[model samples]
Target: MDDKEMLFNSGILTEEREGAILPPEELWKNKKGGLVVVECPQRIPCNPCATSCPTGAIRPFSDINDTPSVDHSKCTGCTLCVASCPGLACFVIDLTFSDDLALYKLPYEMLPLPVKGEKVLCLDREGKCIAEGTVENITQPRKDRTYVIHVSAPKNLVREFRAIRVVK
Candidate 1:
């Protein structure tokens, strides 16, 4: 099978694969303030996420090929894993960023990237619009090709929204 088919059928980013990669809601609630959820399911020989973690919080004790499992207690929300991940599957969600707003950090590699303070359409895992989110921050180091976008959304949609699109 072709790579696209493989990816869409059962790869790490597939809907079926989300359950295997995403942590439970209880875990997120318990962690509350700072934690990362790496939705990486299919293990096809990659470890950039683990390698870029400065705190060694992204499965520091596991094998290179092992899917990243965030040690929430140890994670500092550094976001290195999000930018370094080859598949752009890594994400950092801060549920306690505010009383009614949550922060979502995602890897964006699109043209005319949204700037901080820009309003964008928040999307779910399947790319469906769920709500409107504000672009709180955009961090793109010269050395990194992937841009990290920090978006603020309603607390209720924290788990439902996974991506964003340009306002236009």
Candidate 2:
């Protein structure tokens, strides 16, 4: 079997309800798995984020024009892709453990970022907060201008935490 087939067979090509979800590499490990719903509309010339991944958990395979994807099994949810994404289109989520809690790793490039201890409302792809959550932490790597922000919110809202209130 070819790589694409293998990837798909392994659930790389996940069941996306819409464009909110990332394809390969980023599907929910199970039906109850945590999800990062990317809503980036354009797939122009962008490759830095995928190319910078240390685990190759992200597929930067052929053309840069292709949308970057994630491999949840291989992905440690390290948020490397979060920092590397030039378009700031990558995110990390951990939904394996709890029923009421979901941890989100997203990119933030803005002034006055929420502190680790600050709580914020969790928003969906359309910018509406479905639930309330706390900002667990933040990481800003020099290589990637994007700041990786870890937010802890309701587990049920895992599939909805896409962006905070900023642009990258």
Evaluated with TM-score, which candidate comes out highest?
Answer: 1
lDDT of 1: 0.76
RMSD of 1: 3.9
The lDDT per prediction is 0.76, 0.63
Off by over 4 Å in 1: 1-33, 61-63
- Note the residue pairs that clash in candidate 2: 25-70, 25-71, 26-70, 49-84
Question: What would the per-residue lDDT of candidate 2 be over residues 1-168, giving only the tens digit for each residue?
Answer: 664464345523223534445534335645232444443434578777667777776665598687666564556566666776666667777665456666787788878788877877676655776776778788885454788878877766555566675322
> In model 2, what is the error at residue 141, expressed in angstroms?
3.6
What's the CA error at residue 19 for candidate 2, in Å?
A: 8.0
Q: List the residue pairs that clash in candidate 1.
A: none
